[model samples]
Target chain A: MIEVVFFLVFFLFIFPFAISYVLASGKERLNIDLNYTRNPRYFSVSFREKLFKAIIKDSLLKGDSRIEVQMSKKELVKYGKFNDLTFNLYPNHIYVITNRAFRIKKGTAVKKEIYALYDLVIEDDCFIRAVACDGVCKIGNDVIIVRWIDAIKSLYIGSGCSLGIACSTEGILKLGKNNIFTRLYGHPIITYGFNEKEYKEFSTIIEKTIRENPVQLEGFEDKPVYVKGDIFSDDDIRLKNVIVEGTVFSFKNIYLENVIVGSPERRVSVIGERITFGRGVKIYGYIQANTKCGKVS
Target chain B: MAMGGIMILVLKGYIISVSLLCILYALRHLIFAYDRFMGKQKIFYGDIIDDQLPTVSVLVPMHNEEKVASNILSLLSKTDYPKNKYEVIPINDHSEDKTKEIIDEFAKRYDFIKPLHRYGGKRGKPAGLNDALKIAQGEIVLIFDADYLPPKGIVRELAVNFKDPLVGAVMGRVIPVNADKNLLTKLLDLERCGGYQVNQQSRYNLNLIPQYGGTVGGFRRDIVLETGGFNENVLAEDTELTYRMYVSGYKVVYANRAECWEEAPENWNVRARQVKRWSRGHNQVMFKYFFKVLKSPHLTFFQKFDGLLLLMVYLIPFLLLLGLFDFLILFFLGDINFIAPVYVMLIPLLFSGFGNFAPFYEIAVGAVIDGLEKRVRLLPFLIFNFVFYSIYISLGFWQAILDSIKGKKEIHWDKTERFRDKGAAD
Candidate 1:
């Protein structure tokens, strides 16, 4: 009786399972052949094995890859490398990503949304709007960044990477060995990082560096900007429908027309010469100028 | 006494012929399987030398096509063919409506728009095409139905295939623009997807004969004129043209990338009329080209076999209906013995099997390849389609065959009615 049951089970069960495995393997091979020119990381599992696996509660045949992980900030702090992973970053999400090493220093809240698909290494004391690193990236301290959509942003070595500008990447970004960043301004990226000895090989990369105080151009999307105090700059100061709380100084041209300076008792003054104002340019101050720039209509 | 012998002889021939057709139907599924799984992927050529592209003339045959004429003309004006090289000829086939007016307006606006108005002709698409053939100045003549919205690059894509000297004609793919209009249109959409995307594309990928649909396909002008142009008597001039081209050692290439969107019939009544007309026309083509397809030397043996099966696709329903008629005769003759041979018992099952599930298999395979497995759930309703086709398609096929034999005088080209969404005409 035992021998008969064994024989029946072997023929009816084990034999079919073995045959199915072979056929499923053949199907897997065919899938590989069809998608060989595409990304090999993606797999197309045929429906037969998938159906059978569903019937037998076999999760192995169904994919264990492509994990959808949701972790708390405390849990993420203890984690490292991820492969074929999509994360649900909810509370306490400090967005720092590296290839195999990702770290967010304590007390630095994340600013921008982080969607990582590349290998990245980010240090603490940073604010990133959004960064999608497709290649090796090393980011250091005291940086505030915004996200931009690109296919491959290869390598970034920003230590005090503050007020950085966008990079001109032709699909690949090659950086030199000693390419450390003190502060970067509204200038585009300069790839091919320099060696330590060849740091003086290049004259200038950044357009302007603001270290003393923050240059705020806030709420550009929804609201017009309002400055509260006196502005001192050696650049062209163009204003439209703006109220100045105090006097301006040394501007190349005071392009102000319908100016609304301080309170009626404490009206401020504009201290520059050249000014060409449109119909609604306003500053709540007085105009103390050497000469106006354009002819008034 | 001799009448009985003759009856027996007739019955024997019937069984053999019906069995042979059933086997052919089975073989069609086999080919569909091979195509769905094993056929090469269809390739599109994006880089073609502009200077080497031939000058082409496009013909749009219209009969009371006022609603669609403006849209079609607008689309044709935007086609990516070289401006000076291609001319649009809208053949206004004696319409009592504003089709001619629309074409005239277009011709007035665009210098390349040339209108061909036919006052009196044979009153069919083939006849309109024949009239337009005279004034078409290009080396190649492409045709589009009045309702098609050919994409910008479709014309260029179809024209590039003609760069191969051996290619005498080319056919492009079609998707339904109003596929979601109704259940009937939705089913028809899936069927069209199966027929074109899966079947025709696979046939092209396998180096088999891909059919030249009357519209969205072009042929060499001189070659078509040499083959005596479109036959006005044949309802399916496309099939007849396919045979003529193949017989003369020329290939009809299937351009899978050259896709155009067309409207499918939205109602069941309209869908029935459309399918019946298709069946009748296809049967006429089958009867006309049955032997010519067999004798074509340009085709491989497999191609010849596949072509013959394709030719007889419309007549399969009739054969199935006849199989039932044979069973009835047998039942009356007291041959309904349960103790008969297993093969004899399985005959009805075979016919019903083909009638019931062959189309489902085709649709399922097509849905799989097209990533439309979600729609495969709707396939159980094919029984209703089977019953309807077995009756109506069989009637249409027989009528077409008898009409050919008896030389029926009046063959009307029944046009499918259009449902226009004025806002979405663009």
Candidate 2:
């Protein structure tokens, strides 16, 4: 009886583990892709840019008078989507590259990555996929971009436009009121009613005054407060009229006005939950906000 | 009578001490499992896209790595990072194989591929890195073992963290390339999952010290150079660097998404040697930095606590081994009345459950989180691995103690054997 009891106990203890061991799956090999790389081209703009460049290169080599290459529906269909009614590509489509200035009609449900050498304009309520323009890009009100836009020159976005994941310009990015965007990059990202000419004039004047007097800004009686090291805070950070040479990290919200983070020679980072930048804030580095980031008064 | 009483008291004290250590470690694993399952994950800076990226120097230290050298080199040369912005430096550290020839061939082909041939030097990973660091032109230095295959975006993902001045170093997730090769590799793959997916990520979420494993990670050039390059004597320069950064008021961030594939040891002999080396080097670091961690003003209370626990991880196995002997001695002597002596048997089960140096629950949670359902069935097999680990760890621990007694300053480096065929390279 004792021997039987011992055997039963041992069996009970070892049965589940043994069964699991036998029936267990051994497909634990991880797939490693050698050529796997995230596309550096935001929204596949490089694809359109390369296509444009290739066409131009071929035209120049052939000495063609007219530098234009048009693909028919058959050719375009190979790339992707097609609109049967309009006989033009739309909705989840591929590339549309052209050298001349182009305009999209109002309320057009356009869905293709476009690259234009000259000016590109979109009328009100037109939905886009992605666009890259060498010249100025004028986006209409209520425009919705599904991906991104890159304008080598000025980019003016109209009011109530949902400006996709990213919108960048080498020149100024002028945004209208209630324009929603996750990321915006430009020389100066300005809001509605802020004229570019006036903004440039105001900025030049401020630069001249700063160069000449180096005067202390308002609410800062202590002149020329320069921080040589990083500023880390576990709480909310509010800085005004200060120059930080290194990164600024705040566990909570950050409010900055008239603050310069890093010089052109050295770039730093600003990390916070919600960052609000007032006027005259110049940053030479990266800015990351967990929740929301905006420009206030 | 008095002598026996003293012996019993000492034995009981040892038992209690071991029990407390097990509980502390078990609780730590429980906390890690719970946090991993429920806590809000802290996001890394991989998604932040910017055009103005910093220059980087990728260092691949090779010691007879001819079998896998070309594989890493070819993959690195084709990365998405601007070719001009990053340079791949493959350090040929006293290779007796065709590693030098292979690296030189790459150098001749690509301008960015600079080969550092170290024929006459103290031949080790640290020594090779020290040589490379002297001539590396980039602001950031990314290191990779010859066996590791980094994705194209890994450089950008790692380099982006340096934008934050407080970030001294960044670590990436390591997955085993040969996970399906054998049972040993499969177990290693699971451990990797638990360590990175659960252990390292939870530490980062809680703002604790996340270890920078030497490969698949990068650090600011100046920060490490300022403190003198990696110590050549330390076998585990990665652990040493991790602690050095933390103790010196710099932070190490873990990029869980920057996953890189590495070839784990395919056989038990290789695994034993690898684990033994880790135990030896890690315990050496423990002895070296245990007091420094306690006194570091940069570390918060919890950071110090976790740092100490991390430092003593290698020594835990040794203690558990001693605890087993203690329990057996008590049982044989007919003195099993001290605080429910049968509980001592659960020490191994409690401490090394379902994971490698992690409790079973943590590994299970990690597998669940990683969506690796079938792999969880192999949890019971880990008991055999625990016994294997305990013996080697105890040996390494004793070796460290002996090294301290002899005041040993330097130890010879033994590289892990590679299983990849020469034809595997592109």
Candidate 3:
């Protein structure tokens, strides 16, 4: 019985001590080392290569192609034959468009083709006259177009879109399908410092515009052209040499000239050489425009 | 008839062995309780101060202590001690983070705040302390860790004890700041109260040498330097030094009034690391100094006897293991009668439960009430103080035993986590 008791005590107490002694000695002699290599450019290139392949696979499986208008490549290709087919290519490729505007009228059978050049992807689609492009533009499905677009990189236009006159866009212009632009005006010429009678006539016209559509004018040094309608533009709208009698809501900048803003009671006119509007505008109220301040008889 | 007699003898032997263990543990509880509580002997404030105040260099050794470094610096900045009489030296031991930056910023702000940075990896805590000790300009050097926030009059209180020519070192009471942080901290707080308030005081009352804890302790700078500062090789240099001081016939005094608050580990893993390190270090001290303690002609017979008994206390776990072995043997031998006196073990169990854990519970509850009255967040940690911490201490005993055999003398300073609570500095 005593022997059994001693053995149990030895197992519980002494054995642990013996084991720890051995492990501790072993731990003391162990060493660790690490290596560092400096090659950031190579690392980034390899990382990008992997990322590019993943993006392509993801785009193909789940990409929506509803709004993209197919363009005829028969005139573009050397063989001059039209084909409606999708093509696959390597990851490193760039796509560029030579011309800004190419018209795709109604009942036109357009050819769809893809071009790849050194890490850039370009899609050939039906174009419009006087289009704008800027930056790296990504076109989504169901893009609507109501005006001409000016861009830096790519312009993705939606299908079945009508163009308004004197409309322009800069940078990348992406449009949703079936968008409409009702009225667009070219530069207007108006003389400054008009009499009160001329200001009253201009004020009536501006008030009439504000009563119509929702419009917002911003970044005007003088009182802005109160637009009751929406204006969509691809870039900044410079309002120089322009008079807005109605609500002008533009996606681009609005440049103003020596113009008069008219209200129902009176007309306010200012002589300004240049004023600009950013992004777009939406107005829910009244607007008026005049060339010179004058009394309305 | 002879076999029956032999069976009776075996049964009797088992009962006797079990009863003896029960009696010993019961006695240990009584002594531990009496020493911790009733045995506390303190010198009145008026009786200690008799001479000119000595210049005190408070050496604060820090490593990766950026979080609480500001609080410690601010606390030291508010000390009531004479501005010129004391200097605060914060030794940064090769911290990889913003610890040095914070220390430098504080040093620029306060004239009394001096910062020292070490570039090489830690040689050990003792090595860091020794490095700080080399440049300490005060007559008395006080050691405080990064977590310790000494009370306003602490330096004055600790310094007063130095008037006694025979006193080589003075150890102050270290109270846990976040006593109610969790069960682990509460248990640690209780153990400290039992140890410092009860055991240490009792030893002081009995005129025996109480062990010096590493922090919140002060020593005569010259005496410490003469004794070779602190031995970097030993695990528990404080315990080793305490033994050496006693053998050299120097009196080590316990200053219970000089209080400092320090944070205790809130979890079992940290508590285990701390306790294992402490126990292993104490064991190493015991091994290194046991012979010298016996051979020293300066120590009286009673002091030598007390030292030896303290040495034997480390072996108590082994004795408990033996008792368990006897219980197992009696069960397997098909002798039901032999295990009859197993109830005897319950006596010590009950005593420790009531004497140690119950008092610990009372103190924890009181600390919580105080914290609540003071509107402190530490009140919440009082709930699980016993369940988590008691298990950790048991684990520590096993780890200590293992560490002792391995001759693992490397100094691993397991730094305590600090909270951002501004009220804790108060």
Candidate 4:
């Protein structure tokens, strides 16, 4: 009985503990790299730029001034592969590197990713998988983007478009009416039918009223009316003619009329479940809406 | 006979209370694990692209940190945060080594690199930071220990959270740079993964208090100043700052994607000192802010509950230590009842006992989430860490109690020993 008990203890407790200690004593360690690089938003643009540079530098290339070098299957097979970037792309994946403007024809179905280095314009009723442009990008009406669309410069989308996962731009994003999008990132996003003339008189009147008779909100700092701290409210927040130096957050809805949030030197954010912008609302930073974001007529 | 009966009752009560505390902690860990594994993740502001980023001052507190000062400074100099908008302030607090020379060299090279040399006054990190805060010119202040190596995008990732207005501070994830050094570093890496990836993220997701870790995190300068800067007396100024932010109606956000690397203690002695110091500092903050959190009108019910529980975490181990003695007394007296229903509660209690600060299953879950499944084999080894922590943490608890009894005001800050050579950083 003693021998049997010793064997049981040896197998169950002693063995596992001994193995762990030995492993700890040894020079073995888990593979955890500290320097991990993440892909930037303009990853495709940078990748294409690098590839173009490599191709131009290659002594094997027969052409000197070939801006639009269409690689044959054999050339594609022998292309210089660098890092994770492979030339094993599908036939549908188009690489357009040009100094001049390019246009995707009307009703074109872009089944794979497109990396364009020049100004890009897509015609009406097009279906795109993903597209990244180094310059300005203009999309026509009824276009459907299945994955993502990114542009380095001003991006304009016509009415009745369907933007899939995300539509981001380094510059301004002008989104037309009746567009469907999951996420958008831009500096000063403008929607369709945003007419300055429509609410000019109403905005002037509201601004005058706010300046004359200012009402106090609970979460905001009192006096002088210039908000130094961020404005946060659990309920709907309505601001008129207030210059805010910080971010504004409302859990419910936000209505802004002639309110200037942040400055060129200091950028802030305004976020809410739903947001309605009145005339003369100038935001110098990020803006996000969970449900719906629009401008009042 | 009456005395015997009273003693038995007391023993039973103590056991029951300890068991319940164990259960509560286990439940908390389980909830955090589940929330991280399956629940909808709360998105951080790292994805937001803004050209007009806030002016930031990156503060690096140093004391005889000549070994790793230049590495962090080099990394900070190359950060993606606009050089014109941000500045690096390396606080050299009474370092009687080559630290000053190294910092001065960098200061001369980079215009944005400003070195703050504190030759006198209090010598702790909090005291050093107070001096830096006075000269800081940015709207946002990011703190980094001299040993840490922050990534290029960490500044941008942490700074964007300030746009929330409600967020007073933002904490990033910390990975051990020398995790593969030894068993101790490996274990520390696992603990860190569980702590940040699951515990902190879950707190952020549930709208509870996400702690603002001193390093690899940034906070609004005005908010800290308005709340009377870092308390020079408090050792765990980070935990104190966390509670202060919460009570003052400001929030601290956690960014899981914003990862930085730091060297973990390679030896047991250094690890013990680090734990004891953390425990002492954390317990001090607990005593300081326990009532303040309860009375705060800004916190929700869940926030208050979580905050209180977090404050009492260090004290629980000491209580559990006492409960062990209580259990022995009851067992010797033959007054203990080994009933069937008790076994059901004891299972979870057993799991909680094995992994004290971080439960075994919670660490396993964290490893799985972090794609480090191979490290799960090391879960059994944490039993040793649990015992080690229980002893040292209990000692720290006793130290805190003694300090409270004597109304001790003086602070002694012991910096963790850096194992990284100056050449190793390259």
Question: What is every candidate's alpha-carbon RMSD to the true fold?
Answer: 23.5, 7.2, 28.8, 6.4
Best by lDDT: 2
Query: CAPRI band of model 3?
Result: incorrect
TM-score of each: 0.58, 0.77, 0.50, 0.82
Across all candidates, what is each one's fraction of true contacts kept? 0.00, 0.41, 0.00, 0.10
Report the lDDT tens digits of candidate 1 across residue range A17-92.
4453344231110010111121101111121123223323422344332222233222122122444323335433
Instruction: Please estimate how well model 1 matches the true structure, expressed as its whole-model Cα lDDT.
Output: 0.59
The TM-score measured for candidate 3 stands at 0.50
Off by over 4 Å in 2: A1-15, A18-173, A176-188, A192-251, A256-271, A277-288, A291-297, B43-55, B82-85, B222-228, B337-342, B354-356, B423-426
* Prediction 1: B-chain TM-score: 0.90
Write model 4 residue lDDT over A273-292, tens digit each, in one string.
Answer: 66666555556556666523
TM-score of chain B of each: 0.90, 0.97, 0.80, 0.96
Candidate 4 on B193-288: residue-level lDDT in tens? Answer: 888888899999888989999999989999899878999888899999899889988889998988888889999999999989988889988889
Model 2 lDDT at residue B119: 93
Q: What is the TM-score of chain A in candidate 1?
A: 0.24
Q: Residue B254 in model 3: shift from native, Å? A: 1.3
Off by over 4 Å in 1: A1-297, B1-17, B42-51, B339-358, B408-410
After superposition, the stretches of candidate 4 with alpha carbons farther than 4 Å from their true spots are: A1-11, A14-40, A46-94, A97-107, A170-172, A186-188, A196-297, B47-54, B337-356
Model 4 lDDT at residue A252: 60
Tell me which residue pairs clash in candidate 2: B353-B360, B354-B360
Worst 10 residues of 4 chain A by lDDT: A203-212
lDDT of 2 by residue, B1-426 (tens): 999999989998997787788788788877888998998666466654445577999999999999999899988887889888999999999999999999999999999999999999688999999999999999999999999888777888888776656789999999998777877877888888889988999999899989999999999889899999998888889999999999999999898888899999999998898889889989989999999999999999999999999999899889888888887888898888644434654677777673238467888898898787777788777877888999998888998898889988879888999999983932
Give each model's whole-structure lDDT.
Answer: 0.59, 0.75, 0.50, 0.74
